[model samples]
Target: MEKASSVLAALFGSREPAEAAATVTSIFVYPIKSCRGISVPQACVTSTGLDLERLQWDRQWLVVNSKGRAYTQRVEPKLALVDIELPMDAFKDNWEPTDLSYMVIKAPDMEALRIPLNKKCAAVDDISVWEWSGSALNEGNEAFEWFTKYLGKPSRLVRFNTELEIRAVDPNYAQGYKTLFTDGFPFLLASQGSLDGLNELLDEPLPINRFRPNILVDGCDPFSEDLWKELKINKLNFHGVKLCARCKVMCLFVDDTGWPWSVLSACKEMSGREVKGCCCREPLRLLAWAMEMASNAAADHGCRQPVSLVLRILPLLGTVPCQCTAPASASAAACAPLSCFIPTINQENGVTGNEPTSTLMKFRSDHALKLKKTQGKMFFGQNLVCKESLLPPRGSKTIAVGDPVFVLQKYSSNVDAPI
Candidate 1:
């Protein structure tokens, strides 16, 4: 017990969220699972969908290997070489409120292929993601044929169940939270300050895309995301569940989760680890109180049930062997063009194919009780779960870059479960 206590003190380094609510730095979506992403000005956040365009959710489409395992950068670094796009009016051109006819894809030697998006109501197929299994809308023969040719391996294309009710988030962190294709949650949050700090530590100043968060924020201390409890941006409320575990996908090369692992571990190891409790109710505010108030406040607020906790605090691309990063510093006038993000890697000199991009970024966070080295080494973005809501709500819940974000509630950490 004494040894465990020592580790916590070193991990919680002497730091706090150095400032209050910050601005949305960037917004990104992996339209196709594991391929590449598109940065958008706005997205409609939903419990079951990414920012909505008509009704399309981020990562609604996916690619499967011969055995039906979902193909991600975990095993296929070449997946990064593929390019996917979702134009602003992507919905207007090929999609309608009722029918999402198709989307077009392009890659090095392959001609642009327009894959249809009409399989949701069709037959279902046995598909597996990680250890979970579910039925998906298989994209039919043409897509299968195309993917097989493009990947040079047997591959199939599948869509999320249009019902948007199949996959569920880990209930331990989020109750009844549903998602599709994502490793778990519907959202991820990273901070600009964290990325800037990471750049200072690396051989090459990396781009934010290296980490792949759903949302990015600016104007906070480096690695401060690890300190967030609850957050609100636009109409959607997001809770930080766990820090995003680093994956090899970040560096676009398959070397066992790469630099991000080192980055997250550094953040996890430097903090003071005493699992202290704070009032952390909505619209997050700091208070001066005595130790006596802890138990009384806990009983009054209760646990397991969520509250409004209003806050005003805080806070991907692809391919061509894509060199994508979340925006470095985004504003209305100077968004980085799509071309700037996709380029060849000049590995020798550590330069990208095009001129240096001003990328904005965020990393995953953890309520990590790092009692050991292996446990401390694998997290980056703040994993997020959408609040319970019906699939396809009556109105859209939108969030985007430049949107205002608030610190809503308390950070959650359970000492009993560290795995």
Candidate 2:
């Protein structure tokens, strides 16, 4: 096995040993399987994993049978192609700081459904949703009707309840806590260099979306993220729990419409794994295992283990191959063009990209913002107290209240005001 330090040095260009510490640049969670992700600036680290306003796994909204057993996209490859939208309305009055509102799923046909915020409903017929524990869920009939109508197949919706007490086997040999329905672990990490490397290996470059990772880190060599056991980026810290095992999903091709299986044969040939799996399968597991061993090595070396990596936050520049640090003028220049690229509601000048209704509710409450609909326009307010005209849909438009929205342009407003 390669020495972890040597591997790190090879992955990222030469850096001072002290300067090469691991850090988390971004955190993402998908509340529903094969749907969009909710990206947050910061999250609380827990024993179970990241706590994003009580939402985890990202695939908690599942299709199950009358017996309450769960189903995955693996058996129904079409499930991987669905899209979901969580509108802003679901997060209205009942919003809590910790509550996740709605979830949305998009079908292969591109039709979208916004599930209600409520968890209880009727059960679907003949379809049971099963968790990792092999226990069946009672996803109500209403969910089945909704899914069957949209999916054009017999399916039902199920939610991973905190009450179910599902757990995964921790590598440390401790009992794990209940999870919302992730693939099989607490965290997924991906390296920008690794993706870039793979793109170089392929005839054409693929988007990072194909990997569906929970974390994206820059400044590391290709595949170096697999060697980290604990990493701290700015103020965020990550304790990598286990290796994320890969499956054939990585080789599944998603066309412009996001449908898979078009290039499975090609991927098999490319990976030389006709019966083994896709590229993401063994590679992901190998990376995870390497990180765990690295952490153990660091501990054995008698080095002080730091809690969470500390990172100095930087503004996002909306360009391919984005640099972590950039000038204010550059940042503003990058953001200025976003308004014309996105559709917006004229009232509050808010721009939305197909968010699920329930998750939107949690977003509003956590940020203390109110999203109101007026004459087909969506207006936003700060705690229903101070309402401001919606700004143009610049790249900054995606920044929510609780998020650390950096101002790239200088303004003469109250310098002492809280962000």
Candidate 3:
């Protein structure tokens, strides 16, 4: 068995420098837990992190007890399946608008139960919701009644209050930004190759959600992200703070059908149990170091790679164009005009050129490019271009001055790299 210390040392060690800088292929944000996510071609960089302008944390709603402690889905796996909807103008109106959003949890027989919003419906009962840190949040009664009634277990609903800013444990650290209820930090990272490798060893593949990573990267080897201490996706950058240790929670069956011994046995054999409460003993720090080292090693090996990274955006929901003319105008006029750009490598190898104005950007080996309108025009593109295009290899060719390029739609997979 590989000692944990050995793994850590190998991952943290220095290696050959990168020949060329890496670029981001796509970005994704999940507003609600266990539900669909919103994908934006572009986003704004913020001190806390990337802000997609609409996508926010869905699990930000807290289920608390009468004592104000939080409850976790750990005991009730069904909680992982609950769905939430946030108000579009919560940021501007401070939860005062009559159209406050609601949440719904799926019941047996495909039934949907609504959790109410507003002060009038606030006092139903209280329940507890658990955070990743094992802390409990005591939520109101109304939330409790809504959760327990549908879950058939004692539970309650709680909303994340921006006014009640919860800061990270390390204020000076990168993750210290204010947030409601996230695992611990604002981001989570995982690799598709790592998951694929694990599935290869198992009889059946586990769903990616079993790990609950906020950021999923593709095009790299399994477990390569552990080495990335710092990364840039266009104008946005992330400084990885800690390694995410593997816990027993990973072995716990998420389908609510009881624990699966086969999966547990496989995990125990693969990663020896060191931690007590968690299933897997892998430490967050160690994992982070491993990823950083692996990425460096790959770059050193002369393999250009494509990578997909996800970020959470604030203001979970927003208003869209309605049928009414005024509302339509308002919605349409909300965003500034935007355009996508592709940066193609010129024949000179070192030289680069922007795509023709009349040509729509298309997939190419050099790189995928996009241009977002912030204060000025910002470009974003994704392609294997160097070593990272998601698509298979095509012979190297140079673009003529007047060649046409068409911008392709972004991928929707958890890891949205072009294929």
Candidate achieving the largest TM-score: 1
Alpha carbon lDDT of residue 323, candidate 1?
Answer: 20
Write the number of the candidate with greater lDDT, choosing between 2 and 3: 2
Residue 244 Cα positional deviation in candidate 2, in Å, after optimal superposition: 2.6
Native-structure RMSD, model 1: 19.1
lDDT of 1 by residue, 193-306 (tens): 877886675556766776667788998777667656666666555567766654211222312223245333432343221112222221111111101011111101112222
For candidate 3, lDDT tens digit of each residue in 1-419? 46966763343333323431222333344443333333333322222121211114324556543344444433233445554444434322123435445544454444565544444333222222222223323345554566677556565555554332333423344422434454445555555675676556555455455445544556666544544554543212344444443211111212323324553343345343211111111122111110011001100011112221101001101111112112112211111111011112121121222322112112111122221211222211111111111113232222111222121221332122311
RMSD of every prediction: 19.1, 21.4, 22.5
Residue 181: error of model 1 in Å? Answer: 0.4
Ranking by lDDT: 1, 2, 3
Model 2's alpha-carbon lDDT is 0.35
- Model 1's alpha-carbon lDDT is 0.51
What's the CA RMSD of model 2 in angstroms? 21.4
* 1-419 per-residue lDDT for model 2 (tens digits): 56977864443323223454334456566666544455655433322222222222345566653344443432334444455555444223233222355565555454555565655554323322222434334555555676777645566666555443444434242233334555444455666676676556555455555446666666656644433443433323233333332211111112223323423343334443222211110122111110001000100001112211111111111121211212211221122111111111111112222222122223222122221211111111100000011111111112122322111112122121111
lDDT, candidate 3, residue 112? 67
